[model samples]
Target: MEAVALHISNGVLNGPVSAIYGVIALVALAYCVSRGRRDLDDRLAPMAGLVAAFIFAVQMLNFPVLPGVSGHLLGGAMAALLVGPWVGALCVSVVLIVQALVFADGGVTALGANVANMALLGTAVAYLLIALLLRVLPRTPTGLGITAFVSSVFAVLAASQGFVLQYALGGTTDLEHYSLGAIAGLMAGTHLLIGIGEGLIAAVTVVTVARTRPDLVYALRGLKRPQPATAQGVAA
Candidate 1:
């Protein structure tokens, strides 16, 4: 996903587009931390924090997806699937900040757009789509497997749409000249395939946690049990 480039490849601050999202991410992070959920079990906090850190490190891994386009797992869906949406978004925003401030991975000013595209939109959309798909899916392992498989692209592209909009707004390029539809479609489409990896990781992670660390499932709230079928779909 092009959004992955924001974190993996350098030059986040070199451009204005990235800097905006980076800033937005920081602001949103502060808000989430201040108003974040208090019901988060103590045991899960450390896991979630470590998970966020892992996602940050993963972003550093620049995998060449195409000739010029490189990508990395945003991990928003993973975080969301592990925890809840707001919490997951918070996790991603924190990682983005750490990347920009400590590792110099993303741009400082562009944090806003990055937050919008990668953390907020990506996590929220993925969580929603996964939940929806799960609700309608056969409720069998095969169905859940397929749900997990396709869930990534929804969030990936939703986040990509955030990028397309950001690019259109202050992209410093002619929207028409760039062929927004073709690019967005292609980017989202490619990410659809790439997201399969993310989907598998999410599905397996959920299943593993459900089996081993059911207690660690941050999304399990009030239920006292995290139905192995629904690991973390805002179940809280």
Candidate 2:
């Protein structure tokens, strides 16, 4: 905890007044869209809640580098891969907001920036990458694994670059020790390695869904798994 605080003190990631407000506005938009269709089976609600809580738990484990410079799995891609993007974003954002308001892990002032980095950037980038890879890779479990792996890796790196950009646009710290270029490259590179872990988790989860409950692996279905009644009526 103190170590994280020290890292924050040493880190040069700050947003400008205008960008901060813009981030807040975007978060509000996302929050509004996050109602997530209550008509859907309520059982999924518990699944989503559990997934969010598990991600939060993993995030707290922060693997360290020299006791400070470390990366943690924020579960942006994992959530999106498990559920859909809208639900995934809402899950991560909820977790982040709670951390800020209740735990004081991220804080309210910079809450938007944190969301932009972890939830928005991470999920958006990962989704795009996976979509592209799916187009090229064979529609098989191996292909799913490969695509999930690469996308997860780059998404983390892109989030790091996003931070560098955000800070460069409105940074409050002296970036001499960690120049924008160096920071971007180092963080991205480290995240690329971390993505390996993300990739494996995503791949395993997808394959599990594919084998067990095909309805849950929406991405692979090529269509929304319509409710059972719809499928039964169509069959009849």
Candidate 3:
């Protein structure tokens, strides 16, 4: 059997559910746009574009998990750590939109669920966790990397559950062979491994940027301590 595609396809969800989610996604994105403006400036605007591009590219590559299952990078935690949550959500949403429209990676009808899962819910959960972890974790590059790794794992998990919820609400499939519990279990198990891979990528990416341009990292702002003037001068 082939692995399930990372993107949701049309008809997996009922029409009413898909339409409802579409409206929800539109409202959420409108809110993101309002809030994202505050985070966008000369430096962050370019970084947001780059983050979106990187996410779009990486999401194309899927690695095997189980025999019939595969997973790809979600980029929620990575984006949230690099850019503010509002902008991060927008970045991921843009990637999903392009993938669905241009690449046909996800069904156009299922675009709402996809956006709600990977973009809004995943990014929000990751950013919140990152914020909480940063409060206690060391204010250093290593700490931020660790935080990203841990948060990415949960972000994927959370996004998986979002699918489960939608399916429960209005799944078009028969429930005789596959129970909701079974579906949830499979999604959670497969996505847990995928999350680990995502976490590693997020950790490495965040650490690299934090070391070089800490200023560009939204999560590091006000959290990362200023390096000693002499140390900065020497590094420069």
Q: In terms of TM-score, which candidate is strongest?
A: 3
- What's the TM-score of every candidate structure? 0.75, 0.77, 0.92
Q: Which candidate's lDDT is highest?
A: 3
Error of 3 at 62 (Å): 1.2
Error of model 3, residue 171, in angstroms:
0.7
lDDT tens digits, residue span 42-126, model 2: 6556767876897778777666443445667767777766665666666787888788777767656666666777777788887
Q: What is the C-alpha lDDT of each candidate?
A: 0.66, 0.64, 0.89
Provide the lowest-lDDT 10-residue window in model 1: 4-13
Task: Using TM-score, rank the candidates from best to worst.
Answer: 3, 2, 1
- How good is model 3 by TM-score? 0.92
In terms of lDDT, which candidate is stronger, 1 or 2? 1
In candidate 1, what are the lDDT values of residues 1-236, reduced to their tens digit?
33433542443223665665566666777766665566456765887797798887766765666686666677887787667677888888888878778766656666677788888989878778767765666444455456555666677767777776776666654545558778788878767655765666667766665556555654443234335655343322
Give candidate 2's error at residue 154 in angstroms: 1.2
Candidate 1 segments whose C-alpha is farther than 4 A from its true place: 1-5, 8-27, 62-69, 137-147, 175-177, 220-236
Candidate 1 lands at a TM-score of 0.75
> What's each prediction's clash count?
19, 0, 0
Model 2, TM vs. native: 0.77
